[model samples]
Target: MVDRTNADHDVLLTKEAEEQTKNNGLKKKMYKIAFVVQRYGLEINGGAEFLCRDVAEHLSKYCDIDVITTCAIDYVTWKNEYEAGETRINGVSVKRFPVDFPRETKRFDKCSEKVLCKTHSIDEEMEWMKLQGPYSTKLFKFIEDSKDQYDFFFFFTYLYCTTFFGLPLVADKAILVPAAHDEPPIYLSIFNDIFHKPKAIMYNTKEEKDFVIQKFRNGDIPHDVAGSGVSLSEKMESNNSHSLTRKESFITYMGRIDESKGCGELFDFFQRYKKENHSPIKLIMLGKTVMKIPTHQDIKYLGFVSEEEKYNTLQNCDVLIMPSKYESLSIVLLEAWLCKKPVLVNGQCEVLKGQCIRSNAGLWYENYEEFSECLNLLLADEHLRDQLGNEGRKFVDKHYSWETIERKYLDLIERV
Candidate 1:
């Protein structure tokens, strides 16, 4: 069994103690955090990007935070005068630098390719370094040029882009949040082990925490597990559209339109069910499609909605179906819960399965039949849907809110 008592108390006390320290001025230091990621605000379409945006927004309130990334243009155009330099968004600063791509031995343009398990490796990481090294060099130069201007440096993602770039510059004072390590060629484990400096490491789930601890820490990971949950209530009142009615007859999936996300599977299931039963239930997909895939008849693709539209979609949907083959505890799932919508998750996500079972917020299924049965059950039973959604909302309120989770983040920062 896991040691829950000591761990839990340490978490609570650490959070409290940090607040106490800040109040006492024992830890009253304003931080300047340089968040180094591969892509900046324009390319924040995925889970990591979503989390990075949240962290940037929240941390900016406390620190002098600037996001350092590359211009999504090729070497020739990216080298243009207008593309190079720092710009401010809200209260945060962004430095976009020129990125050079290696010879096209493969199909990736490097200008607009998604980083995947296939893309993060010793060979690929070195290539990533070759491509992104100039940008990182400029980032480092920007930091070094303004040495006393910032106090902290935080990097997003583990094996590739940010880890190599941000770790060396900040050294011991750096923070690394390894989002999820599930997608792999197995060799990434070695890079993650060796390259991960003992500066504070943050994870999104207990599963990820344990995985890091087991592999890197010899069953003793000195890290804090943070829920990738966000602070939405502040914006909720202003952005709230309408309360969803029980009469709504639809299911939705939100995320990338990629094969690994199980979009094809969802479409196939919906097609079979629609043909067999003539169910009037609609299936809507939200988010941009990176690859060309076959479309479904009744599936409505609402590609890349705004934040307001995203919440609106979630608010109206009866059920959220997450069919990703590999997920590191989705922000979309948490958002679905926060919106009081029930989720139908793939059974492969053990962390999500634990969350569903423990909170009674949703259900899990292994195959098409089970998925179909769950969908049918949710469609037929209004009472069960309400109960599940209510449970999910409660769980999110207690555990996943930024007010609660931010304290833990602050405590970790104080420790370093």
Candidate 2:
């Protein structure tokens, strides 16, 4: 068993003393692990990237952790944003390699349209993958050269070039965190190779694990559904007089404001409900908006907010809305539950729907009618809202606590 509790003591032993202890067959092995991802930084709010950083930091307590990533920050164009070199962030070592070239959006979109909508050959799909890239030869070389240096290499997000190409180089020791959802790229022939090559897999949710198994027929691989952890903010515990005032009942959405996230559909449904019912309820959104937000009296967009402000707002809101149609695991959904708030999510997403059914902590909507009806039901009954919210908090505490998540990860690592 790994001496997780005595990591400090183990590190204090001198090199010669450690060698002597090892010669005596009494030394405990300290695992060295590497996390490979496309983009990594404090400001990168993308779901898979954030999860990689969080898990790396948490595991650093018991293992030697290093993050291998690209210098790009912008996912859309894969443009280099950070300096291409080694650095330390939050005590984790990060080594970044520059992307060979920034992506051309128009070309990539055209390629995607052809590959996704129309039948294409494997070569055409490979070309599309190149277009959809933060292709870094240097990163690949580093992984190939240093394969024996770490006990295992964890590749995050199956869609990225980093995992697509890098995993095969270190397949004997690669553990994939696919972070997959129902998407077009997943059905491609290349991904079969990526999925089958990993030594083991860490899935974010059971829905994702089932989906991948059914799609790739790779159920034989060792795997675990180890979802990311959520930590409660201390600021959320303290009362802030200047925080959002809940004079009228409101539903809040917190995430990247993009059309693909089902935000446009959410806006339409909310606006129609307001007009038809003449309800005093409002819709509040907090995130970086990538699309044009409709201007209206009932719709309010407060741009990117601080963690304290987010939790405080979540505490005040009647319902937290998660409109994203594709999610392996919604961290914000977990965050809302941590705040003891009920959530409203799109039912089309199997992961979100499964989470709701399992937790019994939120409501889902398939269409505008269902959306409006569920919203009205949650708004009209304060007792029902509180009941759901309390259930959600219990669910989060039971499954998503940091201790539970950390233990799951360490166990999986040891088993693999």
Candidate 3:
């Protein structure tokens, strides 16, 4: 029985100290853990990048944390640190590595900037980038260099970051928090048919947990199911609504606007709804727009709002319209619940189905017609939305916060 309360704050503890702490009432000493994020840091600003930053910071309160990542440069001028050498970031140590880039062309940086900034597709330009990009070779070398330093390793997304870096690092313990199982091939390539299977053992959500268990027979790979959580108290405080007009409000969608995320379906359905009924509710999408289609006028796209703006939008919206074709579990859904907002999720998602059934947080629709119908139903009734929203908040309070999720990781560390 390793004690979990007295986690080490600094200075890596010896094996004897660890044993003594475990034997005593103190929590196990904080292990020196390293995180591999290819991005700059918490301020890098994508959903996965932001989540990684937060999780690393929160975990650091209970463990000795460091981030081994790439440098924030146009080309590959990375070293063993951020500015020059190792630097501390909000109590977490950061070390950067140089990636392998090809023979210089000044045009490469401009093209890279265009692609990343979303100003130009640069899809064609990447052929040159492929020759020049240092991400792959540098990543492998960085992993090989730092394998012996950390006790545990974590990655925000698997296929892109972890599978490449973590696969080589033979750490005593490895954890991955895959936001959603994006595609079958990506995971299949990593862990074969049973990619997420080992992790199901550690997570609590039976829907995701058991589905993974049932999928794979390989019993050797050790993994644990992990989910991210937020402090609901802040959310609860913002749940009350002053704009509670019985008038049907606009349907809102918040997240990235890529096609795979069901953006096309959402737009088509919303357009059809507008054509059929003079619905008071308009469909609103709050995120970066990847497409250039001009048909979605009523479907307003507020590109990349700040945290305050996002919460404000969630608070004001009557119902959230989600059309994800596939999702492991969506953090956006949890955010909606925390705002006391009802969600309309696609029924195809196993995780969303379970969340809807378990919490009554919202409804699920299979097709565009059904999706339109469900939105209409919510529009027609305020009480239903209220009931669902309240229930959803209660469910979130009970299950989906960082406080609860962190304990699972702590337990796994102790047991492993």
What lDDT does the true structure give each of the candidates?
Answer: 0.66, 0.86, 0.63
All-Cα superposition RMSD per candidate: 8.0, 5.2, 7.8
Off by over 4 Å in 3: 1-28, 43-47, 72-91, 98-134, 179-182, 187-190, 193-205, 219-224, 232-248, 293-295
User: Tens digit of lDDT per residue, candidate 2, span 252-294?
Assistant: 9988899989999999998899889978888888888889999
Best by TM-score: 2
> Using TM-score as the measure, what is the rank order of every candidate, best first?
2, 1, 3
Residue pairs in collision within model 3: 3-27, 4-27, 5-27, 6-27, 8-30, 100-134, 199-225, 229-401, 229-402, 230-402
Span of ten consecutive residues with least summed lDDT in model 3: 239-248
Q: Estimate each model's TM-score.
A: 0.80, 0.92, 0.75
- Put the candidates in lDDT order, highest first: 2, 1, 3
> Per-residue lDDT of 244-313 in model 1, one digit per residue for the tens?
2224467888888877778877778888888777588988777877556456666777677667667777
Q: List the residue pairs that clash in candidate 2.
A: none
Candidate 3 lDDT, 1-416, residue by residue in tens: 21234434364556864564455334744577777765555434445556667677666656788776665433233222335246777667877665544335566565545544444433543343353333555555666676665666665554343344454454344565545443442333334422433232344355655655455543345546556675543533344322322233677888777687788887787788888998767666777666653456566666766666677678778898778866666777888888899999988877777878989889999998888788888889999999999998998888876666666667776666
Better of 1 and 2 by lDDT: 2
Per-residue error (Å), model 3, residue 6: 19
The TM-score measured for candidate 3 stands at 0.75
